[model samples]
Target: MSSNSPADPPVRRIDRVLAFMALGIAVLSVLCFFAIMISTAAGMQHADYATGVWPIVAVLPLVGLPIAFLLIVALLIMSIVRRGKAGRS
Candidate 1:
């Protein structure tokens, strides 16, 4: 039911690239967040809050990584919906 043939449209390529980029960012942020959490925990075990751990714990949790994950999910969902619509037409 679609006009597009075996080859994907150029727009699809751009979308794929963006999706991959988002995924990469999300993965990296998640890894970094876990590392920070572990470090924060270990730092707290010694009751030493002066090692700049609080800032990473406070700021990173409130921003950055969550935004990256949300962006990645949004991009992937959008891509899926668009691809479905394109295929149906």
Candidate 2:
């Protein structure tokens, strides 16, 4: 019933952490974006967005998505390096 083969590379903790972090950030960002969209559709004023936590909600997607992209890129690089090393050895 085991699916893993001997040739399969072991998963690293950092990889898992990075992937989860990226996913979580991306999901949260999207949810925030949706919340903004829903609020706007419900007649939220521009002045409201500038106030309090609304600004933070509006900014999260802008900042979070790029960070998630970077995390994904880093994860890819790490996986590639690990695979190359494993293949060579």
Predicted structure with the largest lDDT when compared to the true one: 2
- In order, the Cα lDDT scores of the candidates are 0.65, 0.95
Which consecutive 10 residues in model 2 have the weakest lDDT in total? 1-10
| lDDT tens per residue, model 1, 1-89 | 66666634346676767677667666766766777678777665544544665555445544666776777777778777877876787
lDDT of 1: 0.65
- The parts of candidate 1 lying over 4 Å away from their true place are 1-13, 40-54
Candidate of highest TM-score: 2
Pairs of residues at least 3 apart in sequence or in different chains that clash in candidate 2:
none
Residue pairs clashing in model 1 are none
Clashes of each: 0, 0
Q: What value does the lDDT take at residue 55 in candidate 1?
A: 54
Candidate 2 residue-wise lDDT, 1-89, digit = tens: 45477666899899999999999999999999999999999998899888889988999999999999999999999999998998888
